[model samples]
Target: MNGMLPWAISFALIAVALAMIFAAIRLLRGPAAEDRVLALDTLYVNGMILVLTLGIQFGSRFYFDIALLIALFGFVGSAAMAKFLLRGEVIEP
Candidate 1:
């Protein structure tokens, strides 16, 4: 089982990369603003997952930290974009 671990991790990383590619295509070609926003949100989530998977594969604490930062910034960015879409501005006076 141990011998299969690296292959599994490689497969997972490739799958996530493919997913990210699809998400990027959607982000670029979305028909509407909402669709694009959703795609962007998905892209960030996949990025975080990819980073976490790398951390697990490599046994690196640094990748985990980077993944955490990705999640945090992604959430905040999504929230701000949503607010801007709804109100035309992210911050309220």
Candidate 2:
């Protein structure tokens, strides 16, 4: 298990990077605002996963903290965008 850890991490990083790239393409080529928003959300999620995988590879707590921040901000941003799409406003007036 230990011997395969590095290979696993490398694979995860590559997979997440590919996912991020695909999400970016969708964000740019999406025909609708909702598709763009969903792509953006996917990009952030992949980013967070990439960071967590790096944390595992390096055995650093700092990466975990950064991943947590990414998850928190990504969730909030996605929620705000969804709310705005549904009601035309992120905050109630």
* Model 1 backbone overlap count: 0
Model 2, 74: alpha-carbon shift in Å? 0.8
TM-score of 1: 0.93
- Please provide, for model 1 over 1-93, each residue's C-alpha lDDT reduced to its tens digit, 9 standing for 90 to 100: 459988888999999999999999999999988888999999999999899899988898999889889989999998999889999999999
In model 2, which regions exceed 4 Å deviation? none
Per-candidate alpha-carbon RMSD to the true structure: 1.2, 1.5
Point out the worst 10-residue segment of candidate 1 by lDDT. 1-10
Model 1 accuracy (lDDT, Cα): 0.92
Cα deviation in Å at residue 80, candidate 1?
0.5
TM-scores vs. true structure, each candidate: 0.93, 0.94
How much lDDT does each candidate structure score?
0.92, 0.93
